[model samples]
Target: MSHDENNAVLFGSGDEAPSNHSHNPHFNELVDARRRQILAGGAALGVLGFLGVGLPGESQAGERHLPPFGRRNRLPFTAVAVGRADGISVPAGYRATPFIPWGTPITGGYPAFLEDASNSAQDQAEQIGMHHDGMHFFPIDAQYGAGLNSRHGLLVLNHEYIDAPLLHPNGPTVVDGKRVSAEQVRKEINAHGVSVVEIRRDVRGEWQVQPSARNRRITAATPMQMSGPARGHALLRTRYSPEGTASRGTQNNCASGFTPWGTYVTCEENWAGYFASRDSDLPRELKRYGLRSSSRFGWDTLSGDEFERFDATRKGADARADYRNEPNHFGWIVEIDPFDPDSVPVKRSALGRFAHEGLVFAKPRAGKPVVCYSGDDAQNEYIYKYVSRGKYRPGRSDGRLLDDGVLYAARFNADGSGDWLALDLQDAAFQQACAAAGVSFADQGEVLINTRLAADIAGATKMDRPEWGAVHPDSNEVYFTLTNNSARTTADAANPRVKNAYGHIIRWREERRDNSGVRFAWDLFLLAGPESDSRGPNGQALGADNMLASPDGLWFDEDGRLWIQTDMSGSQLASGPFGNNQMLVADPHTGDMKRFLVGPLGAEITGITATPDFRTLFINVQHPGEGSTANNLLSTWPDGPGKRPRSATVIITREDRKRLL
Candidate 1:
């Protein structure tokens, strides 16, 4: 989710600004070596197909290797035209039913949704959270080879953030300069985390909320434990958990990942804006993260420990005496076991925190180290990968494997090759770089605590706001969305457009097909924008059927079809030919792309997943009337005329009940 139009202005653009003092070369200056290599490969290589040229006398063997990735069954549905309709739009034969809107109740006596937004804090805790972002559907009968079961499962999703005006009946209440209603504040807090709801398809083919103990809500006020290398670090110490073993909750969870062992990973993005500090000289940890004297929300202005914790001022003599270290508790990837409602969510800090847009694990192999990828989601930030020290075992549901790992930052070079700089004290290169930068780490824990600083010392490539990542199911290649960076003034091969507003997607093949390898080959998969400005992987402008901007949510289904969703900002959506934020499908092999669905007015199309059988598809429509104020409403989505707009997930399926693709 892009927060630039929201409260992001409160925090200056220093974090989002370009890095003028970095030691690394301009990230986009790719050399001609890759072009030469592609030309030498003739028509056999996938690179040639991506380049959209065919060589004369192409061998039969070339045809076998032509697809950039493994072949997936071509998308069977007709393309949906771009539109600004105030409701869901899908292909002709598909039915998109709005399910589980913002206030839907699934647990705790099942409180019915009240249209006037009078739900209490406790009621909000038991219902679905607002602004759904990333999600996954866990099948109920996976043990019996029914992983593809379309009938029953748990739907787990992250509620990125809430719009205060749309959340309350008449917006938030203010007395003088402080928030006067603690209940409203509590409700807002309750709506800012992850939700695990049990859903099942009935005989009539409609998915319904199932009443079960597994249905749970992990809110911002929920109790959680801290784990990994930085678990007991002094930086994590606070009044809430003096030993640094626990944290309160997760916030700004933008995207997610699911473990092979049936667990969910929710990433904390833009979480720094929630904290405030009065200290004139803030620590680098807080300052680099954009923490100001005033937070995005005035939760600190209210009384009580829960609300006061938002203020990270150094009022007390020690960290334990105040909530100064509270902000550190967030910004880590939180692991949750949705099937076990009694389990406590753990903040896995070993992944190395920044604005973690999402975490996408590579294909896990038994007896091999677990590897995963994440993007920082801030201008000039870098992409990261974590290689677990412990070998991954099939069906091991523990997240502790993520605790002991070497977190690496990517450095994309000009020759289409990249190195993963280890952010470890044990690495000689890291030590030398740290010495040159006049920075030293007290211990490995400190290095993990200050991950962004460690990456800087190691000289990682500055990216154009890397976001959601997806690993190709067959090729094992990794792709990440470089969602626009308006502050960027210089263009390079990796990021070719100055003030890149449309954004682009980049993918790479790891060295020797090993996810833990330190080196890789990369290229721009697609540049997202209007047909006039954007270019597809084939070096041609995007056609009418597939024009897009701000590529955000991304996924590859079991069949290897790449599902791309957009998150165009208000300014871009209004000015560009792209009618609204949309979801598109693309063939990784042939580069054939088409628009799948277009969202309602002022909404972002994100959080997509499907039944194992590919018979049902689920996507989220977030913040329909995004810029709506207390007195003005721009759209009423999922509900008609005069109704309050609510963020909800839409379940799409073929009208004939056939497989989606």
Candidate 2:
């Protein structure tokens, strides 16, 4: 996919504290008073309707056509106006605190963050990484804030990419076609992968990271194990992992998923852009995966073979000599056990490989296989799901079930119905389809390695740049953001707009509510745009309160409030009404949406999570002032003026310590 904006954490205390705790007594009192006011209004309206007069929201028959608010669904808040603010803006009753910015020291002996944007590679590795994206918080069985496991936890976050100029003293320098600084390249490499550090709240209720032995950085150079179908495949036979059972680092991590067993799954997105392959005969799998000439960052330009491995071109007589297979090692769902920094992150190949945005599991049922959903965040790509071959056993993190699974790609039919086409090589139809396309899929390994091609051959439906997918905490239904596909010339029934720059959300329920079921029903949930009433594919228009565009990050809080985030960059971000990639909340049933929070200029609101007690919320503001260059500075956020912009996480809480609706 071309350069674009995108999408993402955890908690503490082992005592199983009460899920409901209002730390801010005033905020609770205010919220309660607000609820009481609404109740009184409802009573007045009921009486008016009984007197043959109409209520404010009533239909002619004294009944509402749409679902009522808070029958476990509602957006009971005022929508904030869009603006080009240079900082974050939350709801009237909410307050925000900045925490864990890039290059913030997470390990010992790290230099203080240089406001001028000069930090060494080694120093960066010892600090919080740059471009924070998908993240999770794994509680360490201790309690600190709000007296409800509010403080102690491992905060595992992804550094999707870096601001090259800002990361180096004088920006990246390529002199006579050769990088002048290995330290610079190393810093860029060290700024990515995942950051696992301990975080807790203090007596003042402010969240902060407390460095410990568990604080570790997994960069692009970290060793990663390859498991599943493509574990030992010939295509993965690189010099480092000569046995083809391992690879180094995960790159371009975007969104993420977490397993009940406590491991975090970081998605590898836009990874193919890192490799350069000018040879047309370099195999279709490589070409199909978007490996073209002229790599981004050009990390391989740095001196010596240590940094040159980023270039995935053919070299030597066999695979053991060069990094051609390195690209194959990426694009798969990677699992990291945050609880154990010593545990090697694994590439679960059975999940199938693609531009994985996020891996979200359906509520795992007893005696049933664990199932999860993922979206290929690229133009015209397909949605996918994985079903473990082994049954899920509660309280077991080492399920081994992830080592074996069945991967299926979605085929969204026009009649509000869809099918999950099996992507297994053993499937007769898939075998014939691959054969028809002149592809050699001899085993499960090939199928998983070239999953997109398999999906294409199986006639799986192409989507409008499917981004992040999240399963509802209560409904067990899945929702994914199709983040604006500018490539479509003709409308597909599932994606109605020919050039859908303003994205829509598509949701589906599995047949019989079975996570592994093939058949399903789907409908457009929200049609995003600047218009007050934009109609979805189903001809349902969202009311004035929900105007938005390019929906990217999405998640459901424990109380079932759906949080919506946007990534409207390019011209849209600078001038569009959706303004500055705001975060909003939606009532899934009634279609009520309100802008809950807005990020700083040139930033994408992503990586969202909440405390189990719903007392606090965390969201990442990535690449703030992304429009700026090293010299042309655009945004200076978190700390105002004269400092280089850095991606950081924002902590929000209701004034009364109650859960945000």
> Mind giving the per-residue lDDT tens digits that candidate 2 earns over 221-322?
898899987888998898787889988888788898788676788999878776666555777568778776656766665647667677778876988898
Candidate 1: where are CA atoms >4 Å away?
1-26, 29-73, 143-146
Tens digit per residue, CA lDDT, model 1, 573-619: 77658888999997777767889999999999999889988889999
Clashes of each: 3, 12
User: What do the candidate models score in CA lDDT, each in turn?
Assistant: 0.82, 0.73
Model 1 local distance difference test score = 0.82
Candidate 2 Cα lDDT to native: 0.73
Q: Extract clashing residue pairs from model 1.
A: 28-492, 28-493, 28-494
What is the Cα-based lDDT of residue 461 in candidate 1?
Answer: 85
Ten-residue region with minimum lDDT total, candidate 2: 6-15
Candidate 1, RMSD to the unseen true structure: 4.6
User: How far off is residue 228 in model 2, in Å?
Assistant: 0.8
Q: Quote each prediction's TM-score.
A: 0.93, 0.87
Q: After superposition, how far is residue 447 of candidate 1 from its true place, in Å?
A: 1.0
Name the regions of candidate 2 deviating beyond 4 angstroms.
Answer: 1-73, 142-148, 397-399, 536-544
